[model samples]
Target: MSIGISMLFTFIVAFIGAKIGQKLHFPAPFMIGSMLAVMLFSVLTDTAYFPKEAKIIAQIVAGIFIGQKLTRSDVIHLKYVIKPTLLLLVILTLNTFIMGLAFSYFFHWNVLTGLLATTPGGLMDTTLIAADFDSEIHIVAIMQLVRSVGVLLLFPTWINLFTAEKAQEEPAEENVESTRKKQPLNKKHFLIVLFVGASGGLIGYFLGFPAGTLSLSLMFSALFKLRTNISAFPIQIRQFAQILAGSMVGSSFTREVAASLKTFFIPALLLIVVYLLISYLYAWINKRKDWLDFTSALFASCPAGATDIALISADYGVNMNSVAMIQIARLIHAVGIMPLLYQFVSFFL
Candidate 1:
């Protein structure tokens, strides 16, 4: 019952789940495994607990892990993605209002709640913002939860299934050799990387920007890596972050939230279908335009958490900078702009 004891128990369960996921070779295994395990525990016993601060810590670690991969060339190459990013924002905003209206009409839910529920923002950010409106917070939380978990479960497997042939065609020996040639990690440098990431995350958290904690931490970490060429961090740290994130998400499925799902099952299914269709459609368009490879475009277009997508992109060996840039753009829009748009639409309703 104590916070410390709950956290310890939660981590133990999460670690076991993560190991099982790894053994099964699940996509994004640590996150998916821990999330499923924790969700089951929470729903059954109602004792699972992960502190809110732990989620922030997960974001900080994830940011640092992704940031160290950036280079000057990647920064310069970002300009090439601006067009696709703008196109994505336009499509997503339009879809939000369209879907929100449909949900309101069919489910008889409040317009604002429907909008918040349908918005493609981070689960925590959207749910927190829903509190300010005359909306059903639980519905928003559940819908956003579905969107986050659905994307994490669906996209990686989908992308791999489609791209497996391409991966097989590549020179395996070269890839393995490149990975093996990386310099040994230094403990002091790793500590400094953590310090920079924490400082940036703190600044972002206090600044109160949308998705700022992870974004700023990543920006600072990338800048430090560019400046000093110290981009090494233990792989285990990244895996730990994934487990924490998964546990944080899983623990959100309290009994009350689960009970509400029956009433909103259709709406939840609709949400997943619509988002996936939109993601695939736009991803196809961008691939056709030759703006990015299909894999990168798919990750960029998917309306998932920016940090989550960035962290998973590494496993697929795609262009993470592009994916992160566009996902962050979508996140900022969903968090900062969609609420205002919904407020304006509410008056019309």
Candidate 2:
């Protein structure tokens, strides 16, 4: 519960995450196993072990990593992802808001609390933004738990079912010839991504961009000038980013919050439906173009992290790996997605 212990917990979880990700051959952006373990620990235990004091520090820890990697050049790099990614994020935000509102109105909870309950991001991200609406932290935590459970479990199940239904398409065929068409990574691009992400954080901090996700992403994109520079960040940086992310995510536990979590069933079940429908709808819509992998488009479009589809793909034999790949693509896209979209939005409708 103390700061040191909390950070230790984060590091441990991150280490576990890294190990599991490597062992499982999960080709995605996160440590899915560690996430499930934490959520499960919170669920099974009757005690609240997360400390409030450690919470903000955990967030700051992650913020530093996210902050440091993002730079100025990324301020406006990839022109394409900016619009689509922003649109997707907006759509997800709106959907979550609607779902949260419905949870309040239909389930009869406080509107502020319900709204915070459903916001789609990390649990702490929910709380940080939830404070703006004066929402109850416990309720927000409870809702996030429910949402995380839904995403963690059902995503894999869906992938299993989808892949099973199309067994004929198993062992995806790759286009070796087209592989030559891809772009290569370079140092100029790496620096640009780092620069954009950092600059965006600086800009957002000054302009009230609500934590540095946008700023970090903008700066990262601006810094990475390569049209397809995927290797700008080193493994260490990526690991640090996940540690920062997990520490903040894990530090949100407490006795009161744990007690509040007892009533997480209804919300959790409801969110599974929400997750399934959203994933399917997004996949269906994005699948319209007939890309090499249909699963990739669907997984990329969903709001869940990279591991969900990857695990599902491996577990259920669906193109979940493809989904995971798409997830990476989205991250690459995120570098330039929002800033450019914001610019365009600034210029026109």
Candidate 3:
């Protein structure tokens, strides 16, 4: 078996470990259960079964899955979700910037590198930038890993908590009413998505925004025929797609980085709490307006893969639009805001 597949196995093992930990009533940090297993094996065994480069490739594949998730329907959902989406994308990115600045203030790391270092984006994205500044890839990677683990572990915990709080605040009768209205199914939505996705990608290629043009495929279609109707995107399929995507991405994180991750203790823990709050505050405000489901808003707002966020949102039976919206918003932010922020901070601050 190619070492590439080892990451897949490792991800599966970690996921199963997470489930088992929950079952065993172990208070282990959600990713802790699985991460420890990887750690223990590395300690005792000389074989580096899951090599480093192979893991990187797996994560790159996950990026492909994320890039494809932006079909037309998700964008249609975007209209309804735009408010929360803007709120979240800005909040989440700012959270990263602020948290990085705060962490730097306290920990004494490079400011620019700290932002990249503390980002909730997946491991590679954060580390790539961190590496640019020569700020310790291992530390950057660990911070992202902790953010990912915190996301998975904290999700259900927050779900149960929010559900209860939502219950207490809203009339019990309203909950009963909303649950019924939530149940409906559609497939046309998926077909519309395929067209926009395929056609949009083609247009993007022809038009050239570099990678941004790829999005233009949808941009063109959305610009003109947006009023064109379609079914809604399937919640389960989106989630499953994300799981496959996240697994591909998650698998790439192997023992090598985990072993060298000791210095990440502070940033990792800090990013975890900050990211959790980023999602929480986003949900808390939107929850007030009865926008979408709370946990889903949190899950969908994550700066990670679209598939991952959407799929997690699908868990609550809501479409992944909230997740997808935030993902797109961030990409937009990265394009629009990052350049300015980079210039301002680099020159002024």
Candidate 4:
């Protein structure tokens, strides 16, 4: 098929999926729906493709939105998340090692491949590092996709179930109306955010931070907000980013990858089981030790992208800043620490 035709089909499906998702009030509906639509198409048709740059662009956009949420006050709150973040990192490392070993033994795959597949890092981050380790990229991609989708679906459910009361405690209508009327942003403010987003994204891409494009964009936006004033970005841009990210992730599951999943199903199931167990254990500990509410601790501990997790946490009225900081710290270590540790160990062994 022609590239033009492929692109057309992809967008058409993604648009329809996004509409359906929003109508149904799904969490990150555009992204979730687009991913599911693409995955379904790929599985049924035995073919799938999307622009390679889609995920990166989505990440940058997501970063901008997340960054815009930050202020100096949020930075002051960072100290609160530190203990839970550190504890969660330790838990993640132990969980990764044990689950990686178990998956390797069960699937008859190499230990490194198993580890990469089970790690809570973003899909692209793990896939690229898997390449360096000579692991099976296809397997790693599929497994990571499964891990992410699982987290996306489950996070909201857990929040709704456990945190509904807290969510219901929003300020009254008069207060919300008065607040909105008082602090409306003008065009110049949005332009500043856009400018900073582009600058931060470029700097992040070149410097090679973990999820750098998104992280840096967020950081730059936050700094801009701190120095000036808070402003609103078009919510539609975030939705578009979700669609792009969802489509990219969905299209990654080619027919070959779909066919291969059954071969590794048992291990995949075990990996999910262990991942959740570790996540919940850390969350429970945080709630008890750090004095965070259950919802806040849970969001802080979930193994997912910082931006994605933070957005969902906001929807549920969890402490968004805490979740964002902890998740970003996890991203840094997942992309930075774990890979380097493996590389150094590989040299000796």
Provide the overall lDDT of each model, using Cα atoms, as 2-decimal numbers: 0.83, 0.48, 0.53, 0.74
Instruction: Estimate the lDDT of model 1.
Output: 0.83
Instruction: Tell me, by lDDT, which candidate is best.
Output: 1
lDDT of 1 by residue, 154-207 (tens): 877777766877567445733653574475778789899999998998899899
Clashes of each: 0, 32, 6, 1
List of clashing residue pairs for candidate 3: 55-252, 189-231, 200-217, 204-213, 239-311, 300-323
Ranking by lDDT: 1, 4, 3, 2
Task: Name model 3 segments beyond 4 Å from true.
Answer: 1-77, 131-138, 164-243
**lDDT (tens digit, per residue) of candidate 3 on 1-349:** 5565655565565556555654774322233355444444444542324444332232222223233444566665557787777677677667767887887778787677677666655454456556655355655666666666556656556655656654355455446545644867455654655555556555544653323332443343344344554434333333233334434444444566556457666667667666667777777788898776676676666655433453344334444435545665665565445645655676755
Q: Which residue pairs clash within candidate 1?
A: none
Model 1 CA deviation exceeding 4 Å by range: 166-183
Give TM-scores for every candidate, taking all chains together and pairing residue i with residue i.
Answer: 0.93, 0.57, 0.63, 0.88
Model 4 per-residue lDDT tens digits across residues 65-104: 7677777787887787777888888888888878877877
Give, for candidate 2, the lowest lDDT window spanning 10 residues.
172-181
